[model samples]
Target: MSKPISMSRRKWAAAWAVLCAAGLALTAALDASSARDQQPEKSVSAECDKYIADIETQLAKAKQEGTEDGVVALAGVHAGPENDDCSDAFRDRFGGDE
Candidate 1:
């Protein structure tokens, strides 16, 4: 008669399979989480580009007016709103403010 396989070998094989499945699940979860984090960065970058483009368009319009007052007004607009780094950078770049 043939002998049955040992219980220890059967248990070991089952445990190995379970461990591999758990590892694969963890890896997939981490990859999905990472993908989610990157989406916001991409959207913010697109929004920043839009803001810059709008500013440039306004500057061009102001330039076409061809008056000192118009230029000064455009400079004020370019300085942007108060209490923001974007405005600060705009002022610094165009020599509007500190």
Candidate 2:
């Protein structure tokens, strides 16, 4: 029983819907970019075995201390030695945290 919408009004409504969708998409993209920028990337150049070994050591220590969060809350290392330097330089470049 209601009156039908005019062509202009329908077009306006469609345009409004499109604008809203675009706004939402833009907002989502900005949010994603912000999140990516906020988090520091973990880039360890050390061998995979060594990297995992360090994590395992942290896990073991956390387990002993009854604090699982310890390992889970570890900050990712941004810079690390690419190759294993087992000589005297090893201690200087690589930390002995593990």
Task: Compare the candidates by lDDT and give the number of the best one.
Answer: 2
lDDT of 1 by residue, 1-98 (tens): 99987678879999999999999999999999998878332122344445657766766776777632443333333333432555544454566531
State each model's CA lDDT, in order: 0.60, 0.62
Per residue, candidate 2 scores C-alpha lDDT tens digits across 1-98 of 99996678889999999999999999999999999888463444355446556767777888899986553443443344544332223344345754
Candidates in order, TM-scores: namely 0.35, 0.34
In model 1, which runs have C-alpha deviations exceeding 4 angstroms?
1-7, 39-98
Clashing pairs in 1: none
Clashes of each: 0, 0
State the TM-score for model 1: 0.35
